[model samples]
Target: MPPVQTVATIRRITPVGAYHHLVLDAPGVTGVRPGHFGALAIGGRDASTLLRRAFSIHRADPGTGTLEFVFAEAGRGTRALAAHRPGDTVDLIAPLGTPFPLPDGPVGAVLVAGGYGSAPMFALAEEILGRGGRVAFVLGAATEDRLFGVERAEALAEHVYVVTDDGSAGRRGRVTDVLPEAVTVTGATEVHSCGPMGMLKAVTEIATAAGAASHTAVEEAMACGIGICMSCVLPVTGPDGVTHFLRSCTSGPVFDGTSVRWDDAGTLPDDLEGAAAMTPKASHR
Candidate 1:
């Protein structure tokens, strides 16, 4: 289905350390899946900010017609968004991009997240639990305050592992440092991850080594949010065993971990299967 532009009323905004969690009342909006994102136009329609800022859907309550998203003050766009008050109306283009695929039957799965990348995992955990499947989580960040959902994960997941880089939280290490052990302890058959590209790559390697199926929601800077601009492209192995540039905003944000060509992600290598055939034509004299 095509995306819809809706005027959503801001319910409230809560500050969690350096991040702002915004909840909006979006009635008539439905079918929002975990890992889907929203492109919100901040600073009002007549304000200086023209482009919409994209954020992963943190949580959505269909019954209440409310949607939640979190963001840190990265730049002008986000700072403008933070200045908004309750009762303010924000334009939203929501439930965009592909969602994390579900397993065929109930199976133990491990979810790994870094920083605010954990935004989408909670809703996903709820879905998995509803289907009689069990879920475990590994949450990591640079500091204790950056870890957003540890307490919630502790309550929901069968097991929760927290890690921080500065030794200010959980184990003083990366998620990869403890991922293998978590997979083994939970007897996980699948691993789903959303974080930095490097972290996702590491998780893919670890999960593969453990003989577990891995899926990941990639983080790519997007301009159009939808796929028209072709700004967010990544190399992915096609079904025909050839590498192709897939749009992250449309073809995915979620893809099979094994199908991604991580090393050649941003570049088209000469040895790539279809690289030669896709060469550009010379300019006319």
Candidate 2:
């Protein structure tokens, strides 16, 4: 949001399990909100991965102009991030997308994250707690090895729940297995979830039935990261009677779960209606 600053270099890189945490010299752009993301341009100029990779702002330092980006080490793009040492300048188009709005109530929030989804929610947890709200984090992974940032999340939230499918960690089941317990024990009256499509769906059902407000963060293979390219279209019901396809980039990584057409995850139908998309041009201005 500040005047165009030079590309901030990576000050440090630390590997945390399956994800890498990068500290960049992003000063004026540090006061970013939760759910808003930035674009990090890495790799050589000739590399096929020229465009910036969209990363959720995990931590920010407005004073120092530094940022912490947490990303999974899944492919060449991320591997490029992992390979960065100190003193490397990475171009970033930051502070993009709308933020998650904090709902008011005698509200207790339960954040359910599958894996790296914890990065954004952990940042959110601190804000919620600081505002006198409460949170219980329910984390899930396939096994103990797949679990990441347990200690930090536990520290951020008042309470924590870990669920692993292979039984290698807290409980031998899906993350949903711990929801009822989390709600009952922590008295978390609202829910926010980000993870695999299945887990999000399950949480949606649970929260819907319990009469709890719920939000979901959707994941996809993004091209522009901004909404210029329509590669990330999703189906949604609009204000009018017709349902439509929307852009995932600018409209959301976060959306009201009930409003999202979950059944259309990987394969959005071509003719879906109410297809308004909030491109970066719209969100930034």
For candidate 1, write residues 99-194 as lDDT tens digits: 998766788889999999999999999888888889899999999999888888998986899999998999999999999988998788899999
Q: Model 2 misses residue 103 by how many Å?
A: 2.9
* Model 2 lowest lDDT segment of ten: 273-282
For each of the candidates, give the backbone clash count.
Answer: 0, 7
Q: Residue by residue across 104-129, what tens digits does model 2's lDDT show?
A: 54468898888777778877787787
- How accurate locally is residue 199 in candidate 1, as Cα lDDT from 0 to 100? 92
- Candidate No. with top lDDT: 1
Top candidate (TM-score)? 1
The per-residue C-alpha lDDT of model 1 at residue 152 equals 87
Badly placed stretches (over 4 Å) of model 1 are: 271-285
